[model samples]
Target: MIKSVWQGKKTFKAQSKFGHDIISDAPTESGGDDNGASPVELMLSGLAGCTGIDVTNIMKERLNDTTKFEITVDDEREDNTSRSVKYVNLIFDIEGEVDLKKLKRAIKLSVDKYCTVAHSLKATIEPKLIYNGNEEEL
Candidate 1:
């Protein structure tokens, strides 16, 4: 299991065999040092990263050449509750001459079928996808 020690003043050092120590914070507005992304932001970021990875990998497997995969997530909250992310909108701008059908299918599989993080977060959050380019709606 991973271990972390609180170093005081909104700084905690965590270590795992996976990689480097992670420094987390509560955000400056909430009395943190703003050292890293707040937890909620991290969650959204995880979703984006997870889906992006899956999409890229799938596209590569399909022999689709992509110039870049740009994924952005916007989080929305309700009723002023700070702990829960109510909605998340994901926008993907996939550049290149790849077939729109393949791109859409890859993204769909990532969000709806393959991505573990997306599946885990499906209940608590809503994810919307917007594709920039000629990708036809699926």
Candidate 2:
């Protein structure tokens, strides 16, 4: 479970079930103290984190290289009041001697089969790959 307490000036102190605290705040323009990441940012961060973990575990089990890797999540939002998200992009930047096929399979499994956070979202997710600085497919 998660609990969020309103800190003054459009900020919230949210605690996860595991007792980790995350400070959510609005930007200065949004009448907040600019103390931490906004809720939307945190949500995106959660997606990245969930997928990252899944891929890491899968790679480890498959005996793929785990030297260097990073996941970047990006979303496109509407301009209206709701600011509804249109789609999300999960970019995987990987370096070192990793097997491309295995890496792609691991990412596909995470995005389509194992990631709870990805399954929970309502937007389309496009997964991209960059291997050793070169863009690759799926």
Indicate which candidate wins on TM-score: 2
Q: Candidate 2 lDDT, tens digit per residue, 1-138?
A: 897899898999999999999999999998999999988899899999999999889888554545667888999999999897778999998887878898899899999999888888865768678799999987
Lowest summed-lDDT stretch of 10 residues in model 1?
A: 126-135
- Candidate 2 local distance difference test against the native: 0.87
- The runs of at least 3 residues in candidate 1 whose Cα sits more than 4 Å from the true structure, single-residue gaps closed, are 61-64, 122-138
Which lDDT tens digits does candidate 1 get at residues 81-100? 55466788999987778888
Clashes of each: 0, 0
Q: For each candidate in the order shown, give its overall lDDT on alpha carbons.
A: 0.79, 0.87
